[model samples]
Target: MRQHGLLTLGAGLCAAAALGLAAPHPALAAPDSCSYTSPTHQPTLTHGDTGAAVKQAQCLSNMWGGEPPKLPLDGVFDSVMLKKIKWIQGCHGLPQNGVIKDRTWQVLYHPALDCYDPYPV
Candidate 1:
């Protein structure tokens, strides 16, 4: 798994300033309904799990843009989904085990656009 370095605070601020975008304030980033509605009590999904929950996870992952591009919203948790989930987990500093736990679901619904960490697939 190749890990990429996170952007420094100064660099992030500079980029936001240069782009004329407001730097996101930690306190102002509110949790939205998307996170609330996403799957919470479903069993941990891994390779070969198929159903609505898997499809929902895939759909939410599209909101989380990153390497490997957007995935097809199929109702199967295959290898591709596993790789993407692991990547997202690593990006959010969670255990990169490809398991769709509660925290993983939260990150899927609300993602950072500038995830510097490279997902080691």
Candidate 2:
């Protein structure tokens, strides 16, 4: 009787192992959906006057999903825009200072750095 019980337990263990091997874990499965992609590609701001900064802001706005929150892109560093950019930086897991630092630019423009595909259209 004991021998029969041992055999049954071994068979159950084998079946469980087989089932585990046959199916993928739920965590490894793909997500149900994702968001739309952005349009613009890597954008370089001229950085000398307000116009350049504005242009950068526009490009950033497009990348984000709307117009940039009115930042002076020509290197003037508008306070409002700076706060907004800081928010963006926070989202991107960077320093939140509202300044367009080089690291922030890398995350914003060159997402992949080597061959980034600037979000979606």
Q: What C-alpha lDDT, on a 0 to 100 scale, does residue 68 get in candidate 2?
A: 34
Tens digit of per-residue lDDT, candidate 1, span 1-121: 1232345666775675565443222232234422423445456778889877787777677665444556676688888889888888877789989999778877766776656554454
Best by TM-score: 1
Structure candidate 2, residue pairs in collision? 37-120, 38-120, 49-74, 50-74, 53-73, 53-74, 54-73
True-structure RMSD, every candidate: 8.9, 17.5
Clashes of each: 0, 7
Superposed by TM-score, candidate 1 places the C-alpha of residue 55 at a distance from the truth, in angstroms, of: 0.4
Global lDDT scores for all candidate models = 0.66, 0.41
TM-scores vs. true structure, each candidate: 0.63, 0.38
Work out how many backbone clashes candidate 2 has: 7
lDDT of 2: 0.41
